[model samples]
Target: MERFAALYEALDATTSTLEKVRAMEAYFRSAPPEDAAWGLYFLTGRKLRRLVGGGALRTWAAALTGLPAWLVEESHTSVGDVAETVALLLDTAGIGGTAEATTSLTTWARDRLPRLGQLDETERQALMVSWWRELPTRQVFLLNKLVTGSLRVGVSATLVARALAGVAGLPVAVVTHRLMGDWTPSETLLPTLIAPGETAAEVARPYPFYLASPIDGDPAQGVIGALDAFVAEWKWDGIRAQIVRRRGETFVWSRGEELMTDRFPELLVAATALPDGTVLDGEILAWQGDRPMPFAVLQTRIGRKKVSARELTAAPISFLAYDLLERDGVDWRERPLHERQAELARLVEAVPSPRIARSEPAVAGLRVDEHGVDRVRVELPLPPVAALAADAVGRLAPLE
Candidate 1:
């Protein structure tokens, strides 16, 4: 816990990208694999669901600091952050103890933290207060951040990937890809991640999602090529996700690396039509007769653990597949845009589910030929659009 707290402080104190990367590289190289795995989990923007409520923490902190609830509330508002406020109050109390100085990050994350969920209110409060009194102020701050789901180190996942790539002596792409999907952090997972050979990926793993960079001016003017050199499709206002059907099972993952297979049961039914060992990257949208409903309609269903029949009827879900990443147990991400799209079209046609459909290119001034790019140059009004390219992965650059 102390080492990770120091690393967190170093990362938070830096504005230089190189300095942040160097700090992370140093930590990864020295920390035990178990600790490193958990550190990477949080640093890469993955979060554990909130274990305790903010109200509970505030009440407990006020009681522990022997301050009135109103005063703690005012402190929280002035500090503009609950975690920092709690840490500051505890530090001023000077209650830090030596007993927890050697607690491992793995011990706190894997062993101690999870026990809070099963504890009653009184037990939970006692346990939390004990921990706050014993831990250093920095660790307490991180603990509070974890409890409130507000732990951010002012770094992007791309930078973390770069640092890990340097440690592993592999491309950044490989490191990012390996980090994708739902995988538990364990002692051995780090070794597999840095291995030189292609270790078998989890059967339900997803490829890292490629994100769009903002363009400063008009996209067509700044593209530096003929207009037809690009392909455009509607930037579907829905959950960006990947559906993996392998080993006679289907898994749906959101771009945030959440396993959401059970959220939309209709997609699971529709995915049955897909062949084994196939993966599709696309959007999950709420649909009406022929077109998508507003994104607000989809939000109503996203929070439900079990979709009610009324909700299903209110907003039907559809998976509009945009790219094919795998087919028949083979990876197709390296193929050109045309080849992958051609195969995706054929596969979607064979599927019999109306909920499963292809996201075709724009109908106006668009042409498809032997090559993905058509020679005919034309200008047309652009809606929200996504550009697919043959790169490290089939990067879907959404133009806003």
Candidate 2:
């Protein structure tokens, strides 16, 4: 972290971008014998100038600057910590709130650990997870964007983790996994995650699984045909979730993975029929006749842990089981898309809809949970995150 921080500090010291780049290049290339490291190999190659002169000049430079930042921060994350944190932030913040959320997160991250330390791998990871929970919606959004440091301004989660990995003598890949959480981090409990002894968190409610930028909002930004190659989806506007039913206990997690069972008891009851030791991705839609009930219909019953019979009848929740990530103790992440689909189909058949969504007494049969009333519970809806091919959504589309 000190090395990366010093790099950033050097960037601050320079007056010109070219000089800053050159100075960094020189420092990395001519690092002292004791300081010389393999990761700095980028400096020894033609990459820096190539990155600067690249057609997309800004992107290359941004990527370079952000790597260090991500490395520094990510050193503090781990498996159990990453998934829970990601789940929470996705449910709470989404992407629109990125910048504001980042500020709170940086502040909390500062408090969580000393800026400089001779810490080991585990200590660093614990630190990152500790303060992850305190972040607000905006901070969570910002944290999610840390992957590529896709945007230029804030520190990237990947870079933070990378730095941590480098210092702690852990594999960079491992660190990245911990930092790039499967669930939303900032929206949930990233603050507490980095703290100490916290485990099995639920994501934040009200946030979606992923935040998509509005392409139509700026059609002229070369978006006219950009979506053509993409596998389009409704981008369902509703609460994002992950449903875990294990050993007869069903847990409803928001995208942030916060235990949301009490907030929407109807869904928990419906989850009772699921096979023991199963994880399914689904939407708790405002249900009416097997279709998505209006979001307005769901508003009547959200956030209240206890619901009256009238409330249950008025807004019945349904779990739209989309994909199954785990079944019968098998980790199905590495399976091909078609294979996963088959597995999901089998699981669905085994569990069946009847078991997934129950009816309120006297309220006909199963209906999808309406939006706003309850939330959606996704499995490890992301293959990259879940290590599967396709998530609960449609088939994976190629990025342009």
* RMSD vs true structure, all candidates: 5.5, 18.7
lDDT of 1 by residue, 1-400 (tens): 8877888999889899999999999989999999999998889877777888877888998888898999989988999888888898888878656536778889988898889889999999999999897888898988888867788877788899899999999999778878887678889888888889677776788878766654446444444244444556677789999999998999999998988988899989989999998999889999888888888999998888789899999989999988899999787887877788889999999989889899887636444445543322345332366544333246644333
lDDT of 2 by residue, 192-285 (tens): 2232331343221111233333323343444333221222222333565667776567778765535678877866766676677676655566
lDDT, model 2, position 153: 26
TM-score of 2: 0.42
Reference-based lDDT, each prediction? 0.82, 0.42
Candidate 2 lDDT for residue 192:
29
Best-performing candidate as measured by lDDT? 1
Worst 10-residue lDDT window for candidate 1 reads 374-383
TM-score of each: 0.77, 0.42
Clashes of each: 0, 80
What's the lDDT for residue 252 in model 2? 80
Best by TM-score: 1
